[model samples]
Target: MSRFTIPVCHVDDIDHESSKGFEIGDLNFFAVKRDGIITLFQNNCPHLGVNLEFQQDQFLDADNFYIMCSTHGALFQPEDGKCVYGPCQGQSLISVDFEVIEQQIHIAEAATAIA
Candidate 1:
């Protein structure tokens, strides 16, 4: 299906070594920043389609390494959204396609679908 672009946030707005969640229209997504690289993913955990963060913008594990699911304590690789540990092993968080224009983070989504 066709997609539409929605602005999420500025690249610098995410802060270093942290994540931020956003809810735009009907979409739920989050961004993780580490070493100047930002990764975007859908907020839902694959295990039961639950939001990964225990609280707003707190998706990372205690050590600020992998993305941790608040519901099951699942850990995911930040670079690829791969679930490395916990119940949903081998499953992954859904990655959201995004673009940075003039330092603004923009994600493309469809009017009806998230793609």
Candidate 2:
């Protein structure tokens, strides 16, 4: 139940209007940048508990508006990780607590659970 903050990347490392994957302990997570804001989430799809990206660092759809689960096409809003389409329509992506310190992105340590 304890948590720690681990630095993931610099604020500028994340591409504008895109998502980048990172790992903390054994948990996979991703960070999305949109409209000058950064959002973090667990990288697994809610429907099947699988990695969201179809390919490396490809978490967004054609328009880069939402997080898309490449495995099942589940779409989630970037700002809140809320599922807007696909099998887990009413569910949401697990949001990870993060903070920016001196232009660096730090994610709170998460449990080693994969799903």
Task: Compare the candidates by TM-score and give the number of the best one.
Answer: 1
After superposition, the stretches of candidate 1 with alpha carbons farther than 4 Å from their true spots are: 1-4
lDDT of each residue in 67-88, candidate 1, tens digit only = 9999989999999999999999
The residue-by-residue lDDT of candidate 2 on 30-101, one tens digit each, is 989999999988888889989999888889999999899888788999999999899999899888887787
- RMSD to truth, every model: 2.6, 2.5
Residue 82, model 1, lDDT: 98
Clashing pairs in 1: none
TM-score of 2: 0.90
